[model samples]
Target: SFQIKINLTAPTLIFPGIEAHGPYSIVGKTDTSLIYLNNKDEKRVMYLVEIVKFCDATLEKVLNEVKLRIFQNKFWKKPPLLGELDLDIMKAYEREITKRLRHHKQIRRWESFVNGRPILPTMKHM
Candidate 1:
């Protein structure tokens, strides 16, 4: 699991996949993270389905929405990242889950390469 910081300027409106308002500095990665705004100025614990409303709503959609609000008109122009940049959730909220998928793919790829590496008998692991 990881954590994400909310964009300080994010809107307070509650939309699908959106929970509590923010200014949140360290939001948990789980869909059921208990840090949403509720009635009477209360800190409500959102259900897993509240933050993640199935297919109509998802972590990816939530990120995209945040990304849209963060970049506004420039969202489309943001350059695609080619490395492990997205793994660092501190720089900004993640806009795409592809990076995380890439993480697994890269690890597997590297593992295969390493496992298949040609090695001398003396260099083999005991």
Candidate 2:
């Protein structure tokens, strides 16, 4: 007969020599330890060092996705023909675009005022 002992401890940020935390998803567990999956779906051993590195890389990927979404949405307006095809979706897009543009304009105005400069500099100064 074989007796196996498992240490079912809640995940901790501190290891013997390293102190770091990660946002890893537990996919499975073995008799000895848990298994984790990183943002890229890569399997990682459930240890403090591996979890920390996986979380850092996952955070970077999330940030990049946020930037990509922002870039795609900014300055994007629905075509007029789209309104004819799908009125609700087109209207929603139009409203969102308008709101974003208004917010951008307000930010520009605030920046110019704070910096004591016109939003568009004079051609003579250019």
Candidate 3:
């Protein structure tokens, strides 16, 4: 019988600073075994995935969406500022979206590398 093991850790997100959004990085590993019945040999393969939002998507699609405002010409339009509202709601949404994008990017980046190399670094594990 052959045995395979899979190990996954919690995802990690990093916020550079107030000005900079972040460079979502997801780091994890998996281990599996491939046994050759004829050759009586076993091979192990590791798989990893990461995605990076180094472009406008990070701010426009993600951040803006979470901001819950329509943006035109690089400007965000919010509801009338005449009402008093809970600031915590905005903060919670922002944090959640930020973390989600970061984790998602990490996975996407890894997948892109595995699929093919397009002027990008080669993936060590697939």
Q: Summarize candidate 2's per-residue lDDT along 17-97 as a digit string, tens digits.
A: 222323222122222222234456544444322322333344344334334434444445743322232333323333443
lDDT of 3 by residue, 11-74 (tens): 2322223123111211122321111111122221111122121233533343554354222212
Clashes in model 2: which pairs? none
lDDT of 2: 0.39
TM-score of each candidate structure, all chains considered together:
0.25, 0.30, 0.30
* Residue pairs in clash, model 3: 50-106, 50-109, 50-110, 51-105, 51-106, 51-109
Residue 75, model 1: Cα distance from true site in angstroms = 8.2
- Estimate, for each residue in 24-121, the C-alpha lDDT of model 1 and write its tens digit: 22244543232333335544333333432222233454455445444543345655332233224422444234454456557766655677752444
Q: Sort by lDDT, best first: what order?
A: 1, 2, 3
Off by over 4 Å in 3: 1-62, 65-85, 119-126
